[model samples]
Target: MRVVIALDSFKGSIGAAAACAALAQGWLAERPADEVLLRPMADGGEGTLDAVAAALPEARRMPVTVTGPAGRPVEASWLLLPDGTGVVELASTSGIELLAGELRPWDASTRGFGEAIAAALDGGARRLVLGIGSSASTDGGVGVLSALGLRFFGADGAPIPDGGRGLPEIVRTDAGSLRLPPSGGVTVLTDVRNPLLGPTGAAAVYGPQKGVRDVARAEAGLARVAEEAPQIDPSTPGAGAAGGTGFALLAWGARLVPGADEVAALVGLDASIAEASLVITGEGSFDPQSSAGKVPGFVREAAERAGIPAAIVAGRITGDADVSGFAAALSLSELAGSPAASLADPTRWLRAAGARLAAYRTQDE
Candidate 1:
């Protein structure tokens, strides 16, 4: 049987590619001569660089010194595509994963994200594709602006401290000293469809995930920023991603596109799925969010068009999941010998799950 193992990273446990490898290993053990293809996927959030790099060998990793989510010094990497296009993932610098439990969104900043972009520009990149998601801040990208030489002055004309809490104090924005590569273009890749402000805005929908407890206060602060800032559409798809980093990039002339679509096209995933008899795709969890431009849903749709059976294997599955488009949906937790205990050792569970899946191929009647 020709099987394609396309899966997303298991968040805190293993990367997408590693999961695929584990699955492939089990399948190979069951069917030694079976043709298996492994393709790792991401939602334009974390692990995006690794996914694209795996597909495009010509892409080079460029390291840059930038601030972490908490303003600490760190080294982050961005991809330099062969065609002078740079692929930078904001999660590398401003991701929530980098922050300890004590830090909050009110104090985090996207300044490091901007620094990475500048570094990419300095490296002779003419176009930049910024994957924005899993951000630790809700600063409306003001921190990024500050890094790019745009001064965010308070009512007293003094520069405010970095973060979303400081957004309410901004009285003016100076962009005269901002520097940009002579011939560079910027595009923002995101998975969210929330707006920059209002109930479904970045702060309202994502602030709590970044450690904010007072949603009302955070929403009010963000609303003020929206009122004071220059005109920028926040309602556009993906604009609210990365804590409004998409809106900020849009303000700076970055084209926003669906994260999965961009990555799929770049990796030629459609063609690969077309050639497979069975396409298996999944993520850490399955929910309504998976339907919102995520990889598994996209792969399922593509597989359906090609008359290929698509199956999903997730760590856990919830909600009224629409499996009509897929051949089957399997939750690793359900098949795990010890579901509760397996959460701590996902690698074992994933391998066990893979073996269980392979067993299905052995049953004749």
Candidate 2:
């Protein structure tokens, strides 16, 4: 039997590629004769670039140095596909992880992300695939827009600083030197659906995660951007992604699409599932939200559509998650005896989880 193992990153613990490899190793250990295929997956998040690179061997990495979330230089790379499509993941450029656990809610900027995009455009990429997830700032994407040649000025007609702290002082924007979108236009990939402002908006919903103690102040910053950019619809779904980076991309004429479904198509996941007798997909935490535009849920649905049995192996399966869709559900936390143990050595537990799933298949047969 052919088994396919595809998983998203286990958040900060392990990346998708490494997780897939470990799972495949354990599966083969349990059934050496069985063919196992490993396909890493991501939903417009930190592991997106790895997923694309793994699926498309023709994708080339174009490395560049850019400003990090903490305003320091960091090495980042974008993927350039053979079809002239540039793939940029915001997590690698301006993500919270870049701060190394030090949150810079009001100071971190997405300017590095925009710089990477600008580099891709200069490389002759005819189109773009932007993944906005795990952002570190709540600046309403002003930093990104500034990097793309859109200037923001205060009422005093002077340029404001970068990050959320400068958001409230913006009075007007000048797009005189702004870069135009590619002929094929831009496609923004995101799993989030929050708007750019208000209670459920970027600041109120995600600012705290980025270390923002003053949610009200952050909301005011985003509100100011909404007030200034009346031409761009702040209420658009996913506008809050990456701290309103989605809204900025929309202003640049990019269309937002569901990251998981689009990535599945890009990586030909359905075709893989069709050829496999069993498919396994997972992530860090399998919760109620997993069914909503996340990798594991998308994989499960795809496998069901293909009439193939699907299994799940997550770091931890939340109590509220519905596991009825999967033939078998395993958690690394259970196998490792504790969440701390599971996180300390994810590779070991993931391997054990794979073996457990293989045993389940054997018993069912």
Candidate 3:
């Protein structure tokens, strides 16, 4: 049997590439003679850079230091595509994972993300594609703008305090300080459709996730920023991703595109699906968001177009899931004793799940 192992990261447990590797190892144990293909996938969020790098052997890793989510120094990684394009995932330096519970949205910033972009520019990259998701802040890119030389002033013309809560105090913005590399073109990949302000805006939809309790306050602050800045079409898909990072990128003249399609095209995922007998794809969780141009949904569609059966193995499955295009949808917990136990021991569960999946093949065939 020919099997293609394509999976996303299990979030805090394992990376997409490592999950695929574990699955492959388990499958090999059960079906030593079968042909197996490994593919790591992402939804244009945290692991996008690694996913693209895995598929494209020509990509090179570039190391850089940037400010962390809390304004501390942190080392981050980005990929340099062969075409002189830099691939960066904002989460590497500004993701919620970097913060402890005590550090809430009001204290987070995207300054590190800006520094990463600056580093990419200094590294001779003329084109930059930033994957915006899983951000730790709701500053609507104020910190990033600040890092890029944009200055925000209060009513008295003094510099405003840092953080999303301070956005409402901005009286003026000086974009003259904003500088880019000589010829760098910027693109942003996102996975949400929230707008820049109002009910469906970034603050309203994602602020809570980042620890904003006073929704109205945060929304008002973002609205003020929007008034001073150019209007962004929040209706655009992925506009709401990364706590309005998409909107920020738009303000910075960065092209916003759907994450899945961009990553799929970059990794030649469609072609791989077409050539595979069975395609396996998954992520940490499968929900309505998965249908919003995420990796698994995209892979399932591609597999359908290729007349191939696609299976899914996820960390958790919730809310009456509907994986219509997939042949089978199994959670790692289903093979393990319990969901909580599987989450606690993902590697063991993943290996067992792989073995069970491989056992489905018929020897007579």
Q: Pick the candidate with the highest TM-score.
A: 2
TM-scores of the candidates in the order shown: 0.93, 0.98, 0.94
Question: Sort by lDDT, best first: what order?
Answer: 2, 3, 1
Model 1 local distance difference test score: 0.79
Off by over 4 Å in 2: none
Give per-residue CA lDDT, model 2, range 1-365, as digits (tens): 99988899999899999999999888888889999888889889899999989889889999989998899998999999999999999999999999999998888999999999999999999999999988999988888889999999988999988899988888888999999999988998899999998888998899999999998888888888877667888999999998988888888889999898878877888888888999999999999999999999999999999999899999999999999999899999989999999999999999998888888878888
User: Which is the winner by lDDT between candidate 1 and candidate 2?
Assistant: 2
Model 2, position 129: C-alpha lDDT score: 93
Per-residue lDDT tens digits for candidate 1, residues 60-165, read: 9999989888989878999998889988888888888888565676879899988988888888888888888778898888777778777878888889887888
Give the distance in Å from residue 11's predicted Cα in candidate 3 to where it truly belongs.
1.5
For model 1, which pairs clash? Answer: none
Full-model lDDT for every candidate: 0.79, 0.91, 0.79
**Clash pairs of candidate 2?**
none
Candidates 2 and 3 compared by lDDT, better number: 2
In angstroms, give how far residue 3 of model 2 lies from its true place. Answer: 1.4
**Which of the predicted structures, 2 or 3, would earn the higher TM-score when compared with the native?**
2
